[model samples]
Target: MAAAGPGSAEGTTGQSALAAHLAFRSAIGDVSGSTRRLSGELSRLEASTPGIAGRASGLFVRYVDHGVLQLRWMDAELAAATQLANAASEVKDPDMQLALLRRAGPRLQAAMMGSLLLAVWLDFLHLTDVALKQHIYSVEWLFVDLDRVQKMLKPAMTALSSGESGQVEAVARDIPALVGHLTREFAATREAMRAGAEKLQKILVLKESIEAITLLSALKFSLPSLPPSAPALLGMSLTVGGDGVMMGTRLVVSAEWVEMMRHLVRAGVLSLPTVSAAVRIQAGQVMMAQSHDELPKGVCDALGDGPEVQGMHVTGRAGAGMNEPPRHHILPKEFREWFEKRGFTGEMDIDQFCVKMEQANHEAIHGGGNWKLGRTWPGEWNRMILEALQKAETRTGRMLTRNEILDIVAERMEEYYIPLKFIPWRGP
Candidate 1:
């Protein structure tokens, strides 16, 4: 009989996550290796201009940062998997294994998604390098490949996390097919870049050739995975024309490109804590471009001052629904400290707690938005605050006096709502 592979996933979630992590680490190793090598080569090469050199150096920094992050995540996943495997060795019960697997479902999903995206990003970097060296604009075609890979894997990611053994197996069976497609597409992209570079070299004038190099430098700053509509996100079909020699360099930003960027930020891929700081800073640039004046007349006409064009600076959607809460939330450090100080030793599920806070904020605004510090707390607001405090105390074996609870609620409101002057009500 053949030896079982890590992907066999015949056991529980921990086993499945371990299997997925190992497989992804192995698969991503090649891409990571290439990026490491190229980054070194780029660092050593002396660019013709300081500008070009700066851009090359920037790409190298990103290459190093991304590689480090990928390895860190892989190591953490391995540690978790190994620890679980050891514990599972002692527990003979199948039910216990299943429970462990369920516990691991989230990490497994993240491992698979992160690995697949990293591979795609590495290929994108390689393509960008070739485009600069050859002065041919063939990198756009690679987005089609990236788009296909993202679409293919997203469904698998969903299924693996669904907690059904059969579904996970079904998804696992598709990995080889997925890998095959990615390999084929990347191979095709490299070949195209090589051929395009060779052919373009023959016909390019000196100025146009130099322009290609410059364009490549600009492209390096565009992380293939950062934007929402990034080819890695949903896939992209970009049109390219006008070599700097024949035409005045046309790089048309399409509607799809704009939409992709929105998707990327909204999805929180750009907001990974390690990367979110830089991406969020640039996020305003993206949002600013969507403003009525900056957008194309056609897009502006279609949107007509709509929220899509206006953009939501604040985090939530308008109106009420169980699903209307923000998609992502990070707890304020002060609030966490207050909780800890009160002896709440429970797992701090920031996301769930943020939802409750948001709902409370929403109600406060709805209740005439009359929330002011040192004033009588609204009935509904008081009820929600007490419930949250009681739940936390129950979970953590901590007790908070009524006054303490009120103080916490007051502090929370001051930070989250007072600045906005939560009074939505205005006299006519």
Candidate 2:
């Protein structure tokens, strides 16, 4: 599995998150390895440039400081998962503990994806300078491969459940090898950075600036064992040409790339419907119903994530209905720390908690975008990203501090997602 952060979940979500966090941490570990290597290489690449180091100082900082956070977030996730897993081992219930462990895979996958996209955004805007891009491309090209192996996990899991341990082991073994490459490449990158003593001249007389928009295309494979749209949900696609050596001297991101991107937007938007919000709303309604009386098997199957639903149970004890005031209303200090995340106090209070949680549940398992992001984007994620860029004055050589960068990432996340929501959990 690729590295991921805690993903779109926090607190004691459940058993699956345990595995997810493990996978997530693994991915983040790679991010660190890659970032360190890239930095070392960039340092070498700029060694001979007369003014480039000072010119690109802020860019380098962004790559290093910002990149390191990916690893930290992964650590946070692993910590959270470890806590949950340990707690789960104490549950003493045979079936339930195993079920919890099983859920870890999906959560782990979601976390890995969120980290990748975050990396993409960071790299895309890091420093559009050529050597920097080359350094980034060479190192990050590996991050993209995490998806290939993770995709296989589902098939392996399906096979494992249906009596195919050999297949599961085959895929599981592939994960470490792929992940190790990320580490090994970074070590090599570090060496490359140290070894390169000469710098190339800036010869742009023959090359033009890259095209702004390029098309990224991908191939879709449908498998019968998983959900019908699973492949599409996993975001498998090929990034075809939009680049080439125009005069054997310069590279270009062409108009053709823009057209391809446009096609993707058209196809994706037309073919797929946004399901996260709907799922949350539906799940919330079911929880409300179940709290009232006996929930049907179908409803239980859909909304029976006993762990997430138990937040109310944590505060008010199990069997407490929406109408009842919570008996134990202690929101974690961390939860209360978010600037916009106000404490729970019972205005639809627990009434809507289940709905808020429902979205995350679907996102983790079915590969929904809401949960995949890992960041709780407010309504202004895009605006914040631009604002950060502007504040950095990256083009002008000014840069934000580490706190400022994290603030931007946080604020941008808000713009990317929905209103504040909650789900309390207790796990191993």
- Highest TM-score: give the candidate number: 1
Superposition error at 359 for model 2 (Å): 19
For residues 1-428, write the lDDT of model 1, one tens digit per residue.
77445555434434543443343333234334433544453443334223222453334334434434554554454344344333333343333333233333333434443444444444444444445454565334443454555565557655544433234434433343344344445555545654665676643443353344324332222222233353332222122233110111323333433333333222221111212211211222222123222223322332233554445222222311224343222233335555456533332222212322355555454354554541255444434455567776787686874234434544555554532111111112
* Off by more than 4 A, model 1: 1-79, 89-121, 138-167, 200-428
TM-score against native, each model = 0.29, 0.26
> Taking the candidates one at a time, how many backbone clashes does each contain?
7, 31
Please provide, for model 2 over 37-101, each residue's C-alpha lDDT reduced to its tens digit, 9 standing for 90 to 100: 44454444345232223354333444334334443544444344344334335443322233233
The segments of candidate 2 whose C-alpha lies over 4 angstroms from its true place after superposition are: 1-60, 89-91, 102-107, 121-428
Query: For candidate 2, which ten residues in a row score worst on lDDT?
Result: 214-223
State, as a TM-score between 0 and 1, how close model 1 is to the true structure: 0.29
Query: For model 1, how big is the CA root-mean-square deviation?
Result: 18.5
